[model samples]
Target: LAQRSKAKDWTRLIYSTALSPHQIVRGEPNAADREKDEENDDDFFTLKKATDVDADSMDATKETYPSDQLTKWDNEEMFDSIRNLFITGRNDP
Candidate 1:
């Protein structure tokens, strides 16, 4: 879950940087982008360092599961997985 969250954060960051005002105005990332990039660089390094610690902590807390098990899931299981992906408690309205 932590890794998934990080991946989502990275996706958001990339899209945000790609669509920033400087990129729209200059048709390319430039000096203004550099400022935001520097901030993201700091975040990257911080996330990298934290990942090392998180990896160790997660290993101690989470149970190991076989990756191949997903491939063996039945139709019902696959449907449940797809449903879970599209429907979350947070999106309820």
Candidate 2:
């Protein structure tokens, strides 16, 4: 589950990378559209996700997404990924 969440985060980054100059710079979602967006919750990528599958049956799967699985990005590898990204819930880098 933890890994899925990680991948899910990365997937959002990948999708955000696609935008026309006009769409990105001048076209923005209006308040109503934004409110509607808040109501939509779909996972387009199966990357590190915070969701669980069936807990029974042969196809049942369990997933967990605690922050302790990986080292903090405050180290070298993270560099400045946060500056370009809007990560939430983290008290620190």
Candidate 3:
């Protein structure tokens, strides 16, 4: 990974054509093989520099955490009670 970082213009977005060991052993050809035949091989791995985060879909591919007002239960309060079970015990007087 460090060696790839040395390249100044190296882009962060990455596209990879990877195959499982089983996929390779079964002689099932994939984009990797076609890439090799086309002289686009990069040390047996076909990787492309991605320009956009969601190039094809271009839709919002992110999720936002629930806001305080939207949350049903207070997470901190629940954890506090669970933690108390280890430090304090309930008994009948």
Best by lDDT: 1
What's model 3's TM-score?
Answer: 0.17
lDDT of 1 by residue, 1-93 (tens): 455454444455556665654334334455875686568775644443222133345436666778776555666756565553464623433
To one decimal, what is the Cα RMSD in angstroms of model 1 from the true structure? Answer: 15.1
Q: Any idea what lDDT model 3 has?
A: 0.50
- Model 2 stretches with alpha carbons more than 4 Å out: 1-19, 24-26, 42-93
Please, what are the lDDT tens digits per residue for candidate 3 over residues 7-39? 523232222335444443343456876676588
Which one wins by TM-score: 1 or 2?
A: 2
- Summed backbone clashes in each candidate are 0, 11, 0
After TM-score superposition, what is the CA distance of residue 32 in candidate 2 from its true location, in Å? Answer: 1.5
Candidate 1 at 85: error in angstroms? 56
Give the clash count for model 1. Answer: 0
lDDT of 2 at 91: 48
